[model samples]
Target: MRGDVMGCSSQSTITNFSPQIAEAYAILRGIRFAMDAGLLPAEVEPDAKTIVYLIIADAPPLAEVGIVISDIIHICKHYNIWVLFTPRCANMVAHNLAKVMPAEDLFYLEEYPPYVESFVLDDKAM
Candidate 1:
């Protein structure tokens, strides 16, 4: 995306939210946002390998977060989306955003949050 963030969202979840569910939700949100913005033929790079495998295989949701994965699959039916799994170390932006954003509110922005600037810079240099 030319070093320009299309949009970033910090989706805070319940105290008991499963990590898998949270990851799936994040991917789901990203897809929906891109679709709404008319950004088709997207490629998603998620750090969760399980979710990526499930989505790619279009597998039935057997896990607790299957519902979210199902939704992601449904949405992909309307457009071309390639889901790839990235190692956490290479996904610094998402990793830092999860650590820094307040759990009480959802954050959406076109620019990297101040807290995430350092990581973004590091990523760009990679």
Candidate 2:
């Protein structure tokens, strides 16, 4: 559901969107790219399901997220992955961490701040 996504160019890659939207787009794109590149096993293809739940602290311009979501859904349908949206509360620790932590720290759990445990557990639960 929630993830610390990094290394995405919001300006160019995610059109007319906020940084958070771009970040979400990057994860979906990354998944598709990984599958196409043989990084994800072929066994996880059509009929293999993955539940994708993305968490956001603030509501985005739904129109933009919709467009990307549609595309993501199409690809996911091909791979049998279900995509879901969830609202995240402001008190979520990952939100605070993203505002202050370095990119590398956000990527790996061992490197993240201790408070991120809640976020990680919620992500895994999804």
Candidate 3:
């Protein structure tokens, strides 16, 4: 969590899944981005404990999010990644970033967005 922000992305999808599913999708997308950028030995700290447990336990996910969990598991298998459960407060930067990002697009930030800058700074100061 102390590393520099390498990149960020947003994906807007039309689906009837719950917010948890959407979060899982976003986490998977981030992992893929990091892998593509050759950022291995990654540690993915997600605010969703269920998703983190599923990945850590290597158990089958519920039907609604099975596909996403599968993809995440596949990526983790190919890289040195650890999916840890992070509290929302500790994950404020990502939470705020998700709020301010455009829909359906992957954005690479050279700098933090204005709205999330404070959150980033707060995390850094911790």
Candidate 4:
């Protein structure tokens, strides 16, 4: 395993989305990305505790957020996964990036934006 970020991604919703929906969708996307990129045995550290708990409980397969939560549950069925809860303040790089990133889909495989770099370094120091 590498002691560095393998990659990161951000995507626009194309239209307005509620905070909870956006967070669930982003987590779903991140899980799919890791699966697709051959990054097995993944662990997700989410700042949203409720979402994490729902996913951990394997939320129902029906409803809106439940649909996305169900998908995450389904994926871990065949793979190793760990869901860890992290506070927003402890993940400042992610919090800051979400605030300033553009309204478009973007992916960075190791390379990060200049503005994001400092926060990342600060994170490493911790």
Q: Each model's C-alpha lDDT?
A: 0.77, 0.42, 0.77, 0.75
Give the per-residue lDDT of model 3 (tens digit) for 33-68: 777776778888878888888888887566878778
Q: Summing lDDT over every window of 10 consecutive residues in candidate 1, give the lowest-scoring window.
A: 100-109
Clashing pairs in 1: none
Q: In order, how many clashes per candidate?
A: 0, 1, 0, 0
Compose the digit string of candidate 2's lDDT tens values, residues 63-86: 656566556656655664443433
Ranking by lDDT: 1, 3, 4, 2
Query: In model 1, what lDDT does residue 113 have?
Result: 72
- Model 2, position 25, has a per-residue lDDT of 66
Lowest lDDT sum, 10 consecutive residues, model 3, at: 101-110
Best prediction by TM-score: 3
Candidate 2 or 4, higher TM-score?
4
List candidate 2 segments past 4 Å from native.
1-16, 41-62, 82-126
- List the candidates ranked by TM-score, beginning with the highest: 3, 4, 1, 2
- TM-score (all chains, Cα) for each model: 0.82, 0.37, 0.86, 0.85
RMSD in order of candidates? 2.2, 9.5, 2.0, 2.2
Q: Which pairs, if any, clash in model 4?
A: none
Q: For residues 1-126, what per-residue lDDT tens digits would candidate 4 score against the true structure?
A: 323566767666675766777888888888887777777788877798888888887765466778777877888777787777788877776777677757677777766667777777777777
